[model samples]
Target chain A: MLNKIKRILIELGGIHRFVMRFFRELVRPPYEFKEIIKQCYEVGWKSLPLISLTGFITGIVFTNQSRPSLAEFGATSWLPALISIAIIRALAPLVTALIASGKVGSQIGAELGSMKVTEQIDAMEVSGTNPFKFLVVSRVLATTITIPILSLYTACVGLLGAYLSVNQHESTSFVVYFSQVFEAVSYLDIFSLVLKAVVFGYTIGIVGCYQGYNSSKGTEGVGKAANWAVVMSMFLIFVEEILIVQIIQGMRT
Target chain B: MVNEREHIDQHTKVITVKGVSKSFGDLDVLRGVDLHLFKGENLVVLGRSGTGKSVLIKLISGLLKPDTGTIEVLGEPVDELDEKALQLLRLKIGFSFQSSALYDSMTVRENLEFPLVRNKRHLSRNEINSEVEDVLDAVGLLHTIGQMPSELSGGQRKRIGIARTLILRPEIMLYDEPTAGLDPITCIEINGLINEVQEKYKTSSIIITHDLACAKSVGDRIVMLLDGSFERGGSFDEIFDTNDERVKPFYDYNFII
Candidate 1:
């Protein structure tokens, strides 16, 4: 048990240094804009279809689930505001992050793990290119920039789903439904959403890169790297979600 | 038993590793190993698997650090240089890995163009293409330039790997198992390529291999690495014409002597 704790602490220390090195390398000259653009396309554009479907489903389900609860209280009119607050402030970012943690995290982990085991990373280093800057920074920046946008898109799609659900019950107009939605969502909720998106995205990128870059030898190590990347990213995102909510609470107070 | 050539000129030495020792955990891979490479010669480090032949080259190329002692390459101490300085030094040294280490995602053309595009931004697209084609032609693999590395055979991949390194025209080439897992015909072809690169590019090289045939074909000087340190150093025949227990097994396995 003591040895297990020691290993965990050592791993955490390594991750801390790896993340610090990422920032140090990030600020250095000769940034890789082309690779960053390529990763943005990969992280954002490629993920759009799945994210859209998820957002729409979450919106419809949340609205349906809450309608009966509000009806019991004779407060069905409050459905849009409630759904909007919940989706934008919490569900949209969380759901989108979870999806990205599975998709993008696994891809980075597996790709880099293969590269590491094959000696391609060493080859890149010897060839006069900083593989960390070329691989890690570009990927992390892509996730950081793209995940917020993806989250915002998910929120908008989710609201549309909610609107559709409300119209099914009472012929509520789209503009009215949206107005009610926006009225309940404050600057703090949106701020919180964006903060969560950035943090979640950065966590996913760093965890995946760290796992892959330092991946052990052989195919088994690559498989473990990809698997752990998803698991760890999701865990960190949930933990960050709770903390960010507390931060928003402090802001409200 | 060591029967090295009597004529040693210190001025021609391109790489000098003195008292270098490296270890991982409790496993000591190289212990107080002293070696050197002269300009414009292929020095083969022959060893069985896990004898740290690849580790020695990696240390020379600045990919790995040693626990103790110094490594000097092209008149600069490898361990002392910072990142930028190390990168600058790396441009002068080309390391061809055992697995070929080709970027599988990239086409042969892009793979060839990669080192150039990164280091020589001043070159035009046409100039880069010309350089890539020229090196590919030299390696006799210009036909495979449009394909990805995965599409190529093991031998083709190895040639492309060498061509990729040769594109930089590095002064010192470190080849790690250049013919480890290939047919005899392809091994002979790779051997010819190594000698061709040595002649055409005028590059000093340290070819690390367990294959005695590869050592005999391209090696101007041969050193056998056993239990982490060099146990023999001389001509291929001189090193192997021995009854020493550590050296005879390699000779017995390869030749009919």
Candidate 2:
């Protein structure tokens, strides 16, 4: 058990060092603008469908599940306001980040791990190109920029799903439902959601790149990297969510 | 076999590894290995599968560092150079991998253009195009310039790997098992290419291989690495004709023919 703890500590140290190097290299010259734009398209535009579907499903299910409890208090009218706050403040950003942690994180890990195993990374190094700058920095910057946009889109689509669900039972019009939802949401909630998404995105990208870049030597190592990238990024996302929620709550008080 | 250290000019030595040692965990890959490569000479290091031939070449290229000693490539100590300095130094050295290591996402033209794109960033598109075309023509693979690495055969990929390295016009070339998984005919062709590259570019090189034909045909001198150190160093004929117990197994099959 002690050895396992020691190993985990060492791995965390490795990740910390990797992140520091990423920042150090980020400021260097010959920025990979083309690669960064390509990554943005891959991470943002390519992920729209999955993020939209997840947010829609989550919003509908949460409204359906919460209806009985709210109806018990004879408060079905509060459904739009409650669902809006839940989706905007927490669920949308959290779910989008988790999905991206699985999708983009696994891709970065597998791609880089295969490159490392095949010596393509080493070839890049010996060929006078900075693999860390080209691969890691571009992906990280893309995720950081894209994940917030994805979360914001998820929040919008999720509110639409909630509106559709509310109209199914009650006689609320689309404008009335959306007006109630937006009336309940403040600029602080939007700011916090975007902040959380950005942090989650950075964590996912860095973890994936670190795992894949330092992958062990084999096909097995590539699989392990992909697995660990998903696991670690998801774990970090949940942790960040809790901390951000607590911080936001503290600010409210 | 006598060492050929006396014949080489010290000033012409582009790469010099002195008492370099490396180990991973408990396995010692290279131990106290000393080597030197002069200008425009193909020095082939012959060893078995696990005899550190690849490790030695990686050390010369500064891909891996030595644990005990120093390696000087083109006058600067490899281990002491900073990241920027090492990257600049690597621009002068080209390493062709056994697995080709071409970027699978890129086309063959892009692969050949990679090093030039990074190091010679000031060149115009037409200039880069001509350089890529010239290197591809030199490797005789100008026809496959549009294909990706996955679309190429084993021999063609290896040729592209060489073309990618040669496009930079490096001063030193380090080939690690250049013809490892090819057929006999393709292997001979690669060997011929190695010789042609050496003659045309006048580049100093360290070719690591287990293939005797490749060693004999392309090497200006041959060094036998046995049990972690260079056990014999001389001309290909001298090392081949030796009767030393440590070096005999490598040449035994050739002798039976």
* TM-score, model 2, chain B versus true chain B: 0.94
lDDT of 2 at A209: 94
What is the alpha-carbon lDDT of model 1 when measured against the actual structure? 0.93
lDDT of 2 by residue, A104-134 (tens): 9999999999999999999999999999999
lDDT tens digits, residues A161-232, model 1? 888999999689998998999999999999999999999999999999999999986999999999999999
Q: Return the clash pairs for model 2, or none.
A: none
Cα displacement (angstroms), candidate 1, residue A214, comes to: 0.4
Q: Which lDDT tens digits does candidate 1 get at residues B89-197? A: 9999998989999998899999999889999999999999999999999999999989998899999999999999988889999999999899999999999999899
Best by TM-score: 1
* Each candidate's DockQ: 0.87, 0.86
- The CAPRI class of candidate 1 is high
Cα lDDT for residue A230, model 2?
98
A250, model 2: CA deviation in Å? 0.7
